[model samples]
Target: MLQNEQEYIRILRSRLEGTMPHEELDDYLSDYREHFRIGKANGKTDGELWQSLGSPDNVAREIRVTHLVKKAEGNRSARNIFHAAFATLGLGLFNLVFVLVPFILLVVMLLMIFIVGVLFAIIGPVAFVFSLLQGGLPAFSSWISPLIGFFFCTGMTTFGLLMVIGDYYLARFFYHVGIQYLKWNISVITGTECSA
Candidate 1:
């Protein structure tokens, strides 16, 4: 039996706290008032009609919750896309670093290893000549020196490959973890229930 439309809008605004669209709030209040009038014609009091529609607080809470859930879902989609793009960027950067720097480093390291191996090969012959002249136990063990150089070069090559693979996998794992953390935080913050 509310006579004034403005009074009804004021009550709804106080309850909704500016969360719902103003036009929608106006429509909903108009509908509720019409329904209340119908209930009044059917012998219900204003209090009875209000109670049947639900507590104003509960109605407001439901509207707020629905709006927030939709907003959260929209935000979640945006964040997912953003995180995916960022992760792709991170992976791209990781690939660029590993491919360019490691490729260059591997080439330099191999060149250095080749130079050292050649020096060792030359040293073996030089030591052999010196040993023959000095009559000392072959200054460099002829068989052992080449074997040591070969194994050292092989180990360095293996280690360089492993480091590149490890870098790729580590970057992938951290990017996935970071995306999951962002998703979890968004859900927690946006899923909070509004008080009635």
Candidate 2:
């Protein structure tokens, strides 16, 4: 019985020294000891009991593989979720930069130009009519009215275009930064050693 217990202790120690978790090690050893005790009671010698349990290295390897498989599956699930979220957010940002922001800015610029043009168009005829009514001269006597409207529309269009370009580049910069951040975070989580 002493020899049987000593052999069990040796196997347990070696297995525990490996990457196996403490709870699993304890459970495996407890079950094996119980089996050994039963075999001893049934007239089997300590050597026979140890042999029946098979090679300690093989048993340890099996337990380690099981744990590693579980760990791998969990890591895979976490990685998938992480990747999905990153993809969604990146795409959303891309759309906002390349589509939504430019579209909205262009619409606003167009609306402003349209409103200004309409205002000038309305006021031009009214001023010309009032000037004719006054029998003196044009109150806003100038061909400069239409020219001002044209320049205003052109300036707003140019500004909106420049703003769209700036937004696009900024969005691209943010996308790259976000990607780098995610990569760094993943490396940290996975215990990867980053150089420099």
lDDT of 1 by residue, 141-166 (tens): 44445445445545555555555555
lDDT of 2 at 83: 38
Q: Give me candidate 2's TM-score against the actual structure.
A: 0.35
Name the best candidate (by TM-score). 2
Stretches off by above 4 angstroms in model 1 are 1-9, 74-196
List lDDT for all candidates, in order. Answer: 0.55, 0.57
Model 1, poorest ten-residue lDDT window? 187-196
Root-mean-square deviation per candidate: 18.0, 18.7
Clash list (residue pairs), candidate 1: none
Write the residue-wise lDDT of candidate 2 on 88-151 in tens digits: 3444464566456755675566556555555555554554445455543343345446545445
Error of 2 at 32 (Å): 0.8
Question: Per-prediction TM-score, please?
Answer: 0.33, 0.35
